[model samples]
Target chain A: MSTTAVVTGLGVVSPNGLGIKDFWAATKSGKSGIGRITRFDPSPYPARLAGEIPGFVAEDHLPNRLLPQTDRMTQLALVAADWALADAGVTPAELPEFDMGVVTASHSGGFEFGQGELKKLWSLGSQHVSAYQSFAWFYAVNSGQISIRNGMKGPSGVVVSDQAGGLDAIAQARRQIRKGTALIVSGGVEAPVCPWGWVAQLAGNRLSTSDEPARAYLPFDAEACGHVPGEGGAILVLEAAEAARRRGAKVYGEIAGYGATIDPRPGSGGEPGLRRALETALADAGVRPGEVDVVFADAAAIPELDRAEADAINAVFGPGGVPVTAPKTMTGRLYSGAAPLDLASAFLAMADGLIPPTVNTEPSPEYGLDLVTAQPRPAEIRTALVLARGQGGFNSALVVRAAD
Target chain B: MATKEFTLDDLKRILREGAGADESVDLDGDILDTDFEELGYESLALLETGGRIEREFGITLDDDVLTDARTPRALIAAVNALLGAGAAA
Candidate 1:
């Protein structure tokens, strides 16, 4: 609506891959990151599988100064932030302190940190509790630490509304850019694969308990049981499109428009809010249903939720018109990190001219949408619509135009 | 009424343990000038320590005690002062 804000740089730390290059390669190859839950002991629970990042060493990316100050979630965000800034070709010293900012989306702030402190309290008693628990576990820690580390005093905020927050964050970041901020580091990450995080997710009762890692999170499939929770997220560098051009930065794609609404809970027919979000996003993008070349679906994997989303897409793009893909089948649902990673995937898809497959998904008659499955498809993608819904009643849609 | 005093070592232990089980902390640093933030002590650590102090001395420590008692020496002083005041009342 204001100065065009494009995702100029991207950094991803996902289960299937470490960075954008590796992630997209694994995504196109249809590799699965799901495995028996090793982050914590999942033996007690039926859902023992997760899409966890393999062999993530914190010392590799983060500095020694941040070692004591961060939780695993914050560390991942910080590392991704570094990669994003580097990818954007903007060094910290060049930017004005008040011009750059950070906004992060999160579902669970630091369950793993809290879990460790809780263990100390229960086992070793009060004297052994760690002070780091206070800073590390809060939901907004990533934003605070990132801002502090980057010296960005610009207007910033954190959204804890749920997974839909990822898209919402981009929407908010674009607003900041439009309001005259030069660069905003936005996106999200989660490290909820730990025992406490897993137990909390287990209480939600939506995870796939299947022993098979490959098919654990097949969104839009008749055999879809439920989603596997995963780790990692992408931190994106959103800059004014013109500024990126002036700086000769590589523009991934512009976030044309975004829409956000509430679920209004169980009994609502037509799921009007979701439909409205998608329609609003398309309209804001100045893009018609036909103009939307591809869609990155929320892919809830819960039959009714998945159907609701498909029906929403059908209502907007017409049934089977827009090619839909849920590449999350490989990495599982990263909660607040999911849609942003999907947005990252959309950026890659727009750049590479390929729609990555939804790993193990096989489209059935149940969902009347063109679900990209099995293998990557070569296509000319222009405008891509990304959809997301939070467990706590938040529905959001974002539209991205191809970089070319 | 009897007032209890905490040793400098005990206060140092609280500050060290508050940082969690990781890197080293400055235990023998300047008390008046050094803030808790220098010790990598965030608000959560202060809150945990405040609770522990309350439980240990059986006296209620206000949340602002950390900001007020920034260093190990000052913290021990704050604990004894709070305990003395509690015994008086």
Candidate 2:
């Protein structure tokens, strides 16, 4: 028998807000974090709008002496990790360092620090560059920094498979717990607002260039174009159900099932790989299709991609249409942090028995999915399926059940 | 441009701006003793300030320079050494 992995504590540092309270309030109110870029000058780029985290002072959370050694992505992760640890009431001094681990996901690594270092190396000599630049911009920097700060000496790793990697990290953490690790801090954080990262994303033809924030990302709508990029999202604190129960921890939800599939050819409309992923996840969770209460879709906002997702949901839930929504439209896309945030939102929604609205969606009956829009709907949500697909062809789905 | 000597006040002012310190704080005396958390400066802000200083003065600072130069007076001396190195080059 497999050990169930339950989310004992939750923390978020997203564009929506800093902590779970603020994030939940803002998300329920249908607020959009997308706005003009403040991190760097976007004069040259085609897309000017993004879901940048506002008023994040890293020093408020990190210590004074260790500030120079960590990157912005790491700083964000540390903040969220601290909150999760506190919420779980597990202090570093109280717990055994060997039992706790950290697994994080990053899509673009540390773009801001990397951009700064590259600029310095180009204009000035190599000797002028700070030594901290060597490790700050790497994808694994967040996991490394978090582990070092909290004295978490257990297994630490990073996933680099883009948006899908967030959900994959949670799945990996669940595996860790079953393998005898006590706790796992699993999530993702992204800081891709730098000019170079934006330029790289522009080449993908999936970025929405709409000047208006409301109209920027409209998934499943006829006016769909593409997704807007965002920064700063994370959720942490997962433990074995038995271990958490022994510790008298507050269980948020259970990571019941996880399934992932890749379409060899992306953007072809050739096959619905998402259907297989959804079906496989339900089978893994031992739940039937009719038992799924809600779905958190990928909602890429490209016309073809949206249609594929819509078709997948219809095929899974049948013609009755399951209540589906995509909150990514509000925060743009967090890349590595996208699905973890989605999973967190799903867990909260199931716990609270409320379905969050899909922001900025027009009324369209043709899509065939019941999209909750404009207002929160009360529902007895027991199970939620969170879906995410990366830029190239990576597709991931996770099934989370409410802890009774 | 001729090698310009950076005064203690100049370095303090740059650090204060980079750290997002309040305007009321004494640039010369308060900056040296100010903690990183109190000044709202993190790794990214420090790098940005360091980059700006290197570009403006045409000088490169080593890791030891940042570690050793905690006070405004010490930073000014390090800047002077870098400026001297640039002049010799």
Best by DockQ: 1
| Model 1 chain A weakest 10-residue run by lDDT | A263-272
lDDT of 1 at A32: 79
Candidate 2 C-alpha lDDT tens digits along A1-404:
98999998777888888898898888878888888888898877899899999989988777754565566777888898889888887787678998999998889998787888789788976745655677888998998888988898888899888888898888888889889889999899888888888998898888988889999888888788888999878767999899889989888889989888887574575686788888889899998988999999888888878878888888889754689988877898999998888887887787778888889878456778889888988999999999988776787889999999
- Listed in order, the DockQ scores are 0.18, 0.08
- Tens-digit lDDT string for candidate 1 (A1-404): 37999998898999999988899899988887889987777888879998889877888776554665577889889988888888888897778999999989989888888888899899977655665676689988888888988899998988887789999998999999999999999999999978788878888889898988876777888987888989898999999888889889888899999999987756765354789999889889999999988999999998988888988999877889889998888888998898889989998987888999987777777789998888889999888999999886789999999776
Interface RMSD of 2: 6.9
Q: What is candidate 2's DockQ?
A: 0.08
Q: List per-candidate RMSD values in Å.
A: 4.2, 5.3
Give the Å error, residue A112, model 1: 0.7
Best by lDDT: 1
Candidates' chain A TM-scores: 0.97, 0.97
lDDT of 1 at A234: 91
Score candidate 2 by lDDT.
0.82
Candidate 2 chain A has its poorest 10 consecutive residues by lDDT at A62-71
Task: Report the C-alpha displacement of residue A351, candidate 2, in angstroms.
Answer: 2.5
Cα distance off (Å), candidate 1, residue B69: 8.7
Which pairs clash inside model 2? none
